[model samples]
Target: MAFSDLDFLEENFIHYAKENTQSNYANKDQVPTTPGQVKMMQELAKQVQDYGVKSRYNEKTAFAIGCLPANTAGVSPIGFFAHVDTVEYDDRFPIRPQVHRNYQGEKIILDEANGVFLDPAEFPDLRNLQGQTLISSDGKTVLGTDDKAGVVSLLAALKYLHEHPEIAHGDLYVAFGPDEEIGLGGQRFDPADFPGVEFAYTLDNGRPGDFEYETFNATAADLTIKGTVVHPGEAYGLMVNATTIMTEFLAALPADQVPEKSRGHDGFIMVTDAQSSVDRAHVGLIIRDFDWDKFLAKEDLVKNLVDRLGQKYGPDRFDLRLRRQYENIYNGVKDRPYVVNLALDSYKKAGLTPRVQTFRGGTDGNFITKKGIPTPNLFNGGGNYHGRYEYVTVEQMDKLTEVLVTIAAEHARQSQTGRDERPLKKYW
Candidate 1:
């Protein structure tokens, strides 16, 4: 059952995959952080207009917003999000997407000289993709399938609805934003742009059946330690090494509570980077937890560690700063179960089993959920995201297109009859 054009999916995915849209964190002060992102966002705004979507590229927020007016009048407006940028990748070599038609579950060579290959034995999911079109990078750079697959699926669904107006649907809004890889895109999103949208979904990562409503509550911490810079031969009590104090602080963090050790609703405190000298030291840490109480406890643990270190060294010697990055999507969506129920229903209609699980990482939905519209995450239909080994198939993308169309049609039908208000179970 072909839901959308497979040729259109492959061609559009390859066309956008070649664009250099890698986001730069160093340029966070800018709206998009790279010229390539701006080019893609603006181009998407123009392209969607051809599919009966009224669109615009907002320079203030770096979001390309579009709205497809409803044919059915009773249903409320719903929205969708997909990023226009990829994570930071090597730009020296351009992204070249290779397509394999009717793959027979055999090993496909990406770069023979560089010893890069996509084997079914290594990625067992490839075995299920037999007889389908597979797409991958040439192994020099990322394939940008993280959210580009999401973008293409959404576009195909929109085009389908435009051509067949009999399939009654409500107003649909789509926003393609920049710097999502750098985590700045959603932070700067203006909610007014989505005017009157009740709920939204971000078609980000995960395989076809995967769905997530809970994400980590996140915080970023920075610590600075000051010490006297006396020579190694200086008097014993006068010389203080900042590196030693930094090491002590790092060692005091809970060993079991880290990204590697924590999984499935568990959270950890991670030291992203640390640099030290005899005169000064700085450490960057991130704290994540799914539970609100646990998240606060983790924050308190760091503050207490700093307090104890300040007592040993002078109180003035330690300075720490903690900033809230984003909150758990569960916090906002927990009370509004219809948003979750609606997607799960749509998935079943699209012939997918609902696999509701916790998202270990955060997404644009985390921030947007806080903005009063409870947004959950839907699958982008791929695996090995944000890397050279990333791959997505035409069938997987068509499945996503099917899911989006189902969500729209189902939402319209449910509006006329009654809303699904089933409570979301806490899987964590």
Candidate 2:
């Protein structure tokens, strides 16, 4: 009684997972930052057409856009986003996906030589995946399940809808984006591609029932400290050590408000990287919070710290640049509760108990929501994302497909009758 083809999900996930589409931050200036992503996006543009979707590859935006026209009227266009790019991994070994059929919750060895094994005891979630077809990496490289599972699930849904013409639905827009791992993909998304689309969902990493509307309101900051360097023998009063200023700035930061200390609804300011020398110093940090006021406060704390240092030294010596990365999806969806209610209702119809939680990290939905579309995140059904331990189950992908199909059909029905307008609960 599966909604879509499980074989299709399994076959396609493995095929796409084998390709190295790891995004790079260093070459982020490029549209996709890597050639492999373009190859996959372009292929996807052509592949989706086989499912009766009108597709195109937008080189400017690096998004493979596909549209399945509505069979019924009155329902507004909705979009689904799945990034083709994955987090960077070692390239020495190609990604080789290992399929374990009818998994019995045993300790599955990925590579005995490397002592790499996925134990159900260590990952208790694997125990829930018993009797399911589990897919994982060969311990040499990533399986790219962070989103390949999402991509295939969307495809399976699209294929199922195409085959069953009797199913009523509205225009279904799908965008396979590039460079999401580096946080550049969604920023480059052109809303024009999904014309008239009011809302969207990003199928990113999570368990099957996971639904996230509130995500981190993120901001990145770069600080540069300038110092006057003098010869050590004559440095008595002339030498101003930049490293010392950087140390003071770092110490001034709220030590309690860090990633390890902060969890659940709490936010954190994390110093990602830092380098210092007597002559000059540079520090890179990022701020994140689910609450808008708290998010801004974190940014202000950094700015105030720099201002105090400037007062002690000289105003010209301390230069800090703060940039907003993305805002919480709650900001965009709060007024329009239907967007969330529709997904939750559809989840119930798909036999899933909606587990709404505040996302600790940001996704493509964050940027898309800021672009006038109230975008939230739906689970792609996987664990250990962005690493060798990453894995996904075929049944989980099938469940995601079922949820998507139900959402489309339910959306059409709701539009004709009445829309769900239930208010979203504050998870914090």
Per-residue error (Å), model 2, residue 355: 0.7
Cα miss at 50, model 1 (Å)?
1.5
Q: Please write out the lDDT profile of model 2 over residues 174-257, one tens digit for every residue.
A: 999999998999999999999999899999988988999999999999999999999989999899999999999999999999
Check candidate 1 and list the clashing pairs.
none
lDDT per residue (tens digit) for residues 9-119 in model 1: 989999998999989999989888999999999999999999999999999999999999999899999999999899888899999999999999999999999999999
Q: How many steric clashes between backbone atoms does each model show?
A: 0, 0
> What is the C-alpha local distance difference test score of candidate 2?
0.93
Which residue pairs of candidate 2 clash? none
lDDT (Cα) of model 1: 0.93
Distance (Å) between predicted and true CA of 31, model 1? 1.4
Q: Model 2, stretches more than 4 Å misplaced?
A: none
In candidate 1, what residue range of length 10 has the lowest lDDT sum? 227-236
Task: Please give the CA lDDT of all the candidate structures.
Answer: 0.93, 0.93
